[model samples]
Target: MKLLLTSAGVNNKSIHNALTDMLGKPIASCNALCIPTAMYGHPWVGPGVNAWEFISGKSENPMVDLGWKSVGVLELTALPSISRDRWVPLVQETDVLLVSGGDALYLNHWMRQSGLAELLPALQAVYVGMSAGSMVMAPNIGEYFASWTPPGGGDEALGLVDFAIFPHLDHELLPDNTMAAAERWAAGMRGPSYAIDDQTAIKVTGGAVEIVSEGNWRHFTP
Candidate 1:
């Protein structure tokens, strides 16, 4: 499996290159399935508003700028009401899975409920995660800015990666995502944890894990 887990989407040349390299092809050749499930629970957006547009600005959506052959939005919350057989094929055909950021627990809940978690491990598509999207790929997410309580009151994440990821350290806008707060949170984690800024990403391909970064990051273990 291959994952390009980022605190923010491809914000710079380094991240863009990292994603392209992981794809093993030109960006224009790939087709992406953008999963905006995490944006569903955002309180900032009122009911009846377009959550994807609110959470993912057109410019910030890397798939659009990367020139993918097609970029389709797959809202995981609507899966239970639809046919899995019909949609599973869309996932199978995509070259990349681009997950947006929001509440980590909410994203995790939907991933399980939508059967996306089970489908992910075997998928040939490269997983591209942004913030909470990246956090949900871990075994668990240590406390940070977002105050999320899982629907089942569970702390477990997808466990796609062995460790927890604490993203957006020292970010400009997110005041709560500070190094002090991250360090404090990481101290309580049961396993290893990584604190990464927006410009950084953790790339994992099978057994190989490497930090592809342009900003500050730190690894913590308890």
Candidate 2:
């Protein structure tokens, strides 16, 4: 699978171009499945309106709102109860997975529990993760970003990517996530990390990484 990790969604032309390049086609011809499970575990997000907004393309975060050939919802929590035949084929046919922001840990937990994490290694789909969705791909999210705790009680994630991410850098609404705070978060990462603004995105394919930005970003080394 290919990864397009964004602080926000494809908020700028550069990131949008990156997405198009990853898809190797216009988004209008691609099929998408949006995951809204992460929002339910976050205090600031929801099990209600915020989740609905994300799925229904009403959220201002700029993900599902982007035009697609078709869009469907894949709630990770519900995957466990249904047979694989019922949903696995649906996933395999989709061109991309659109993930939302909220609690990274919670998203990670569900990704594992829902069998999605295991399936990811073989999928021929692009993964476009926003905020927590992006962070879940890292080796760890750090304690600073921890919201919901998983049963294992660690800040671990899928570790699909070797580094970590400090998203929404310098976002006005999240004053504490400034560069200074990101620096502190990076120090404990023990690997490469990035502080990216809403306009920035990191693209990873075949283990190579590139920064796609139309705004501010900084690479941090531990």
Candidate 3:
């Protein structure tokens, strides 16, 4: 399995370079399976247009423009009534799973309810996670926020990887309270944990994990 774990969006040129180096192609060459709706209730949750419009070249999502062929964009809200069978197969078919940033708790809940949790591991696609998408792969979801209330009152994660993933380590961009919450959670974690800055990434391939970037990383174990 290949994992490209990012803190936030691929906004910086340096970060984009690192990502392209890892993927071995320019950003535009890689076919993208974008899941912006996973973060917002719908892709249109942010501005006037929906996620599909943004990804399909109608509008622009800075994150998508950074790289990605924008082959398909899944809107979870419009298809609320549809079964997971209709969606999971689409996710399985992608070459790279580009999970957009969003609320960690809600994303985790939706993934479980939608049956994505069961289907993702079975697929051989490369998983590229940003923010909340990265958090769901960790052992628990509670670490991402200072104080949050899940719709169903649960904070566990999908556990794609054994370690905890701390995203958005840019102190200038994140609130002090949020950073403190993440730090507290990292301090108490039982297994291994990694704190990744916005410019940093943790790449996992062939059972080996490597930090790829010109940024700092801290490892913890309990």
Candidate 1 displacement at residue 108 in angstroms: 0.6
Determine the C-alpha RMSD for candidate 2 after optimal superposition of all C-alphas.
Answer: 0.8
Over 26-130, each residue of candidate 3 has an lDDT whose tens digit, in order, gives 667777677764546423244345545545544333455554666677665544579767876777776677777666666677676666667777776677777
Which lDDT value does model 2 have at 106? 97
Superior by TM-score: candidate 1 or candidate 3 = 1
Per-prediction count of colliding residue pairs? Answer: 0, 0, 0
Per-candidate Cα lDDT values, in order, are 0.81, 0.93, 0.66
Candidate 2 colliding pairs: none
Question: Model 1's lDDT to the true fold?
Answer: 0.81
lDDT of 3: 0.66
Q: Write the per-residue lDDT of candidate 2 for residues 94-169, one digit (tens) a residue.
A: 9999999999999999999999999897899999999999999999999999979899799999999989999999
- What tens digits encode model 1's per-residue C-alpha lDDT throughout 1-222? 689999878887888888889999998899888877787665543233445463344635454446788788888889988998989999988999888777788889999999988999899999999888899988878655446677567677899888889888898887888889888988877788899998899999986889989899999888
| Runs of candidate 1 exceeding 4 Å displacement | 44-50, 54-63
Q: Which sequence of candidate numbers ranks them by lDDT, best first?
A: 2, 1, 3
Candidate 1: TM-score? 0.92
Candidate 3 stretches greater than 4 Å from native: 11-27, 41-62, 77-80, 83-86, 143-148, 175-182
Predictions ranked by TM-score, top down? 2, 1, 3
- Top-lDDT candidate index: 2
